[model samples]
Target: MNGPGPWGPAVDAQGAQDVLVHQALMYGSRHEYLLTAVPYLRAGRRAGDAVVVLVEPPVAAALRGQLGRETAAEIEFLDAAQWSRGPMHALASCHDRARADWWPRGRLRLLAEPVWRGRTPLETREWKRHDALLNVVFAGTPTMIMCAYDTAVLPGHVLDAAARTHPELAGPDGPAAAARYTAPAEFCAECDAGPLPPPPAVAARRSFATGGLPGLRSFLFTEAARLGLPEDRTLPFVLAVNEVATGIIRDGGGRGSLRVWAEAGELICDVADPVRVLADRFLGYEPPGAKGHDAAMWAVRRLCHIVETRSGPQGTQVRMRVRIG
Candidate 1:
């Protein structure tokens, strides 16, 4: 509306672009938000792109009320704030949508508000990591994603990270390339650099090798239940731990260690194997067949409340936590 946004010039039939336009909209009020989102969606409608609005109810209501029923009728609105399950879940869903729906249409234009009101510092960091990885994950895909952040509520650091994570910044005037943008790979690594705090001393530890998975599962499952882990999560928790352990036996030096413990109202199980460099950055986030057992990571991430993965000289560690509350 004001000037050409990150979506670039007008697109017509057979004139779709191949670029990925990812922008961060820092808005403090309703008016500031409408300035960028309204015109952006209108343009997407004009270009025949699949326009999706994924935001909280209030924001969606505002858009529907402002755009009028006729104009908003064509768009798909999802009542979700912050991704549905988690960032990884959101990543896979977007990829699936883009792959399934991008060709017939020109591209997918998405606008969503990321939730940050009650996240811990570590959780917030992971979201930022996910944001940086978006550029890497969606490379060459025909999609435009704009994530809106509430300036009044978000911490200064989080707002700054928005700029670093997104390649461009969406504003009332228009979009501009972000000067503070960090390359996806570099930023992701930065988010993962810190060493995970050592597992608790009271953790039940067992070392296992080939053909010992049954025993490992028995040990993990027993300990998980004894620790008062919810019955619903205990089985999945054991199965996820088994998956990692089985992988270690088959591919990671034929042996590994399992540690299960309770810490800060959470049940944490960690699987550690010999230091093996796993190359795929989007290992668990990609759709099936993208990487060998990539979907394994996808499952593991979803099955647990939180997962922390790290590889270094110490070894490769995948720690999954399930909330006891």
Candidate 2:
């Protein structure tokens, strides 16, 4: 197999160093997409690395048509829409796929396009955090990841944020170092600094303990329905809020507060506790298997449109949101 080529450094003479080639692909047209992604995939195949692509359905179809079914079959493909269900779920799945297919000493070549046009502001924020946390999550791993962003569809803010998250830029010409890249720690701190807008004036407030979980669930359902949350979304939203409340009772000092409100066509729930249960600054963004005991937060993330957490000397607060009809 050929050694590293255009995208990253060559394998060391002594042994392969754990390297991560994180790049952003800003493509303006279909031809640009083919030009930037195809060569990278070809290089990985030439180097005998496992290649995986996670992208939207349309892009996947286009890639398959361009690469041909037989050739595309050589690389793994996952739906970016599905992967975005939860940031942690997506990260966990990536690691799991890597371990299942290539672990220990195997090298990986992956392309991911997790954010797309029309993403809610809350989703945009969380996914950006997910992108920044990748550096820490995959530190010292022998992997090359290319995260694609469509310049024609995504807004400037999204593109600018993408530039900050990735350390390299891949184009038709080849890869180049990213000038705007911000280290993960600083990027995360910047994101965490801006908490979600305060929950709309609380329509209802309730205090609960472990024994009061059922009552909290019932309260959330009624308030959600009263606040005009879509019937279909109410249950999932309730479940998401329930998980956060449960986390508070189980880990956040045995008692907590829940506040429900409506804000600009969205249902918001704020849960706070006395104990600071989450120690990791990037807890919800990290994969569950890596941190353990994160299933509740993972579920909340998947079910809710937004999940925001803030911890300080006072305590920890979790705010979850879902669109209301």
Q: Model 1 segments beyond 4 Å from truth? A: 1-16, 82-84, 100-106, 290-293
Off by over 4 Å in 2: 1-3, 7-14, 85-89, 100-106, 224-243, 250-253, 262-266, 274-279, 290-296, 323-325
Using lDDT as the measure, which candidate wins?
1
lDDT of 2: 0.78
lDDT of 1 by residue, 1-325 (tens): 2225445433334554666778999999899888888888888887678899989888999999888898799998887654655566676666776677754576788898867767777678877887887787676667788999989788999999999999889988677879999987787777778778898889999999988988888898889888999888888888888888877887789998878899877899888887576665555655565435466777777677667788877778888888777
lDDT of 2 by residue, 149-268 (tens): 889988898899989999878888777778999999788778778555665564589999979988888898889878898889999998887787777777678898878888877788
TM-score of each: 0.89, 0.80
TM-score quality measure for candidate 1: 0.89
Candidate of highest TM-score: 1
